[model samples]
Target chain A: MIASVGNVLVWMVWVGAATACLASGIAVVTLTNPFFSALGLIGNLSSLAVLYLLASAEFVAAAQVLVYAGAVMVMFLFVIAYLGGRADAPWAGGSKLFRIAAVVTGGALLAETLVALLWKSSRLSHSAAVGPTFGSPAEIGRSFLTDHLLAFEVTSIVLLVAAIGGVVLGIQPSPEEETTA
Target chain B: MSALFLAATTEPWWISLIKAAIIINIVLVTFAYLTLAERKIMGRMQLRYGPNRAGPFGLLQPIADLVKLVRKESFFPAAAIDVLYIFSPFIAAFAALSTFSVIPWGPGWHIGGYYVTGYVANVPIALILIFAVGSIGIYGFIVGGWSSDSKYALLGSMRTCAQLVSYEVSLALSVLGVVIMSRSLSLVDIVDRQYHEWWYLPYAVPQFVGFVVFMLAGTAETARAPFDLPEAEQELVAGYHTEYGGMRFGLFTMAEYINLITLSGLAVTLFLGGWHIPGPWLQAYGPIWFLLKLGALIFVFIWMRATLPRLRYDQLMRFGWKVLLPVATLNAVITAIVVVAV
Candidate 1:
């Protein structure tokens, strides 16, 4: 009886969190104010973290908050705040042709997702029901270090290169720009 | 008798709720006293009396401050984002308090047939959850600043966002060393790992550099004195919450104290052997030992606040990214190598 109750409660929590997540995602696009949009993004990210928890992907959920909602979103807010009035700049700068192309590209991506969903219904519905040991940090660490070692190393290299590139590009100005100024 | 009844019931959800309430109340009361403690300690450090007038050595000072703040008028800017401006401080306080849910205060206690752990939630990623919730707190400052419609507030928020993001890197990397050593992410498991070792063999010995980096990054992350460039009184006037008044400002202050306590708690748990008393005699009183360790770490926090001067903006950024990050990364790499080899 207690086990059934616990399972029901978990499902209820999952439903509530997933709904909030979707609502926040909608708010992110619908909110005209850049700051509000960013706020919506935070809400979406956090609720998604809650959903991750419900799914028992505890480490991934925490990382979702730490890296995406926390650090990355803060940077987005920082830039929005720094730019101030410019954050609300109109999309008129983009040509009509460019806007049309963007819309078409978005629609194509949406259609592709829909087609994939319909084609792989059974596999998609499985929800990746992992075993008891699957989402544990130690398990993830072992798999990363051994089974996916190349991908892990490559990711680190990519991040390192990106960091160095950012530092180089940010610190020293181009000679042409310096001379022009 | 209550424990006996509870044991027979097998009602974890209700018991967890009760535990949550107890923990929250304890934390809130402690937060109130912490402000008083900081003032008194800081006053002594600076050679002055601090708030001695309010009910016997300022014991009632936090209460008095709360009353005053509650009675004061809440004023909002004319052209501000009203909803968000109103919402930010509550978010800050909420985020700060929620970080405690996963933090194990001591070993599990068995009363009658019921078993109870110190923490509300004992997820596998307890440490990372602390970091995750802590990161969300930056939004409170950002939203509060952006919505304030003041130049100083905007600038302060921008600085806070940058500083927090930069330091969070070092903070997370520093913890990687501890995670490598403990081989588990649960706070309780980490503490248990320290039980077999003597006092000095605390992860601090192997990850001394990480500890230092964690402390530095934590200080910066919390926006305490020395790393308090976000709300520098000399320049930003009150920083992000400059336009806030009354209970709103009080909430921000309350959140700051809670964050301070959380950091101190983390430091104690990760590096200071948590609730494990050194000698055999005191081993049974795990929760008491845990509180003592937490108090000592909090004192170090207050001591640093009283002594250290705020770092310059440029210097703060440079230290976080250029120095702390690399050092933490190196510490993690070395610890991983050694742990693997062993």
Candidate 2:
């Protein structure tokens, strides 16, 4: 009885979080104001993090909130605020071709999702069994260091390159200064 | 009730709920008194009585302030974004309150059939969760400022975002040494390791550099004095919440104080041996030791506010990125090497 109750609670949480994630994802694209759109994106990211938590991926869930919703979205808000009232609505003035391409891409994604859901529906019934410590920080750290060591190192190097590129771009001399030099 | 008192790990939902309710009330009451305590301490430091009229040594000042704030007119800006402007404070307060849940305040014990764990939740990633929730709390300030439609608020929010995001890196990095020594992200485990393996010595002794970096970064992360560029009232005229009035404004301040208390609690848990005294005899009085240590940290926070001046924006940025970040990284690297060797 207790196990059933726990299962029900988990199911309820998953449903609630999934609904919120979908609603917020829609709101991100549909919101007209740039700032509100950013807020919607944050909401979406946060709900996605909740979903990650529900999936028992605790470390990933925390990192999602800490990195994307916390740091990256704050930068997005900063840029939006810097633009002030002059920031354009995301979908307002795109070219007709661009809009067509967007619609086509969205349609393709929808169709692909439908195909995956219907054709692979049987696969969703059973999940792979794992240890209780799966998705924990220690477990993830161990896997990253051992099994995925090369990939992890490559990712770090890529991040380092991005940081260096950002600094270089930020420190470039103005045209007038360059001419004077 | 006896049946419900299972092991801490297997406690029923209602038990967790009860614990959460108790913890929330304790935190809220502490936050209320912390304001008065800050004022009284500041007054004494500056040689004057602070709010003596509010019922003897300003004991009732927080209640008075609450009543005044609730009764005051909540002025809404004409140009403000209504939904987000109002929602931001709740988000801020909620995030601040939730971050405390995973913080273990004492060692677990059994009384008859009742097992009580100090924290509401024993999250494996409690340390990371604190930073995560804190990041979400930043939204309250940023969104509040952005929605206010005021220049000062906008600028203040911008500084808050930049400062918080920048300092958070160093703050998280500074705790790497602790994580390395304890070999766990759980606060309970960290405290347990400190008590057992380290022979009652906290990580603060071996990881002195990390402790200093953590304290500095924590102060900056919470946007306290000497690093309070976000709400530098001398220039920004109340900063991000300039347009906020009444209970909304009160919520923002409440969130700030609660975050301060939570940070202090975290510092105690991480660097002050948590609820453990040096001897085995006083182990039963865990909560009292925890409270005393927590109070000392809070006092240090207030004392720093009274003693130090706020940093200039450039200096703040440079210090965070250049000094704190590099030092924290170096400390982490050395600690990792030492941990591996020994």
Candidate 3:
């Protein structure tokens, strides 16, 4: 009885989270308020965090909550606040084109989901045999060090460029803006 | 409701709920007091008296402050983004509190002769899940800043995003040294690795480097001292929190402390063997010893905040990528060699 009740509650939270995520996705695109748009993104992101914990990816889950939700969101909020008083450039009338594009994209997404559902049986048998690589952090580490070494190398280059870019962007126009004004 | 009650009636269920509540309370209280201790310690270091008047050397200051905050009027900004603004605090608090769930609090506290291990989940990827939670938590800041409708708040949010993303790379890489050396991500298994040959000393030189880098980056990720450009008072005027007041402000402060606790705990776990008490013949009370170790770790964070100056924004960026990033990658490479060669 206890197990059954616990299971039910867990399922409820899972389903509720999925619904919230869907709602957030809709709200992000539909909302006029930039504030509401960011908020919706938070909801979607946080649900993904819970889903990580549920899936037994504990380290990734915690990292998700900390880096993405905790830290990145804070930065996103800063941009919103810093730009708060500034009005956005007026929207041009490509929304009808956007609607037509949305229809094409939406139809494609629907067709993809439908195909995914139809392909479930064939895909099930064809799924790659995952090794006993789940629990071992060392395996993940080795993978990072070996097979993903090129990616690792590129990650360093990206970070180096990003650091330089950040400093450059952070610079205030070489005192040129100040002199002109 | 009654269904919950019905589930609560199971013998083990009753104990489980009790244990959960106790753990949760312990984590929350630790967070609350750590802030006061940090403030007081930093105050003394800065040649000023901290909050020493409230109760017997200001120990009760957190409690007193909590009461005042609770009574204060929560001023919701009129132009606020509604849903996310109202509940971002809860989300922040929840994420901080949940990170403790996988922690092996104590070696299976005995109950009725069936050795009950004191952990909520013993998954293989507990460490990864912990990191994942941190990732999700970034949204709270973004949401809070946007919802506030303040320029300062938004700028702080953007800084937070950039800081966390940069620092997280170094932070994650630094830990690869330990994970490779120890061969497990499970905190339990990591502790077991320490039993025979201590991880700290064998890879002492590299581990220390990793530890320092992780601490520096982690502190920035948590928006703490030295890397607190996001919330720099003179600059952004409280950064993302420029608009919050009362308990809403209180919640943000509470979240900071919680983040501090989580970072310290992670440090202790990864570099310090978490709750694995040092010294032999004292392993029985390893749990108590572990708490003491964590306490000591938290104390040092406070000490650093008191002593160090905040980093310049450019310097902060440089330190992470130029210095820490390459060193961390080197540590990972060396660790892989050591593991494979062995």
Best candidate per DockQ, number? 2
CA shift at B265, candidate 1, in angstroms? 0.6
DockQ of each: 0.47, 0.52, 0.33
Instruction: Give per-residue lDDT, candidate 2, residue A2.
Output: 67
Query: Candidate 2 chain B: worst 10 consecutive residues by lDDT?
Result: B1-10
List the candidates' TM-scores in order. 0.91, 0.95, 0.79
Model 1 C-alpha lDDT per residue in residues A1-181, reported as the tens digit of each score: 8667766877788899989998999998777777778888988998998887766667787889888898888877777777774356643446889879989998999999999999998998866656767666778888999999999999999999998998888897779999999
Q: What DockQ class does candidate 2 belong to? A: medium
Q: By TM-score, is 1 or 3 better?
A: 1
Model 2: lDDT of residue A95: 88
DockQ-better candidate, 1 vs 3 = 1
> Which predicted model would earn the best lDDT?
2
TM-score of chain A of each: 0.80, 0.89, 0.73
- Evaluated on the second chain alone, the candidates' TM-scores are 0.94, 0.96, 0.91
Docking class of 1: acceptable
Worst 10 residues of 3 chain A by lDDT: A127-136
| Fraction of native A-B contacts kept, per candidate | 0.67, 0.61, 0.57
Q: Give the CA lDDT, 0 to 100, for residue A8 in model 2.
A: 85
Q: What ranking of all candidate models by lDDT puts the best one first? A: 2, 1, 3
TM-score (second chain) of model 3: 0.91
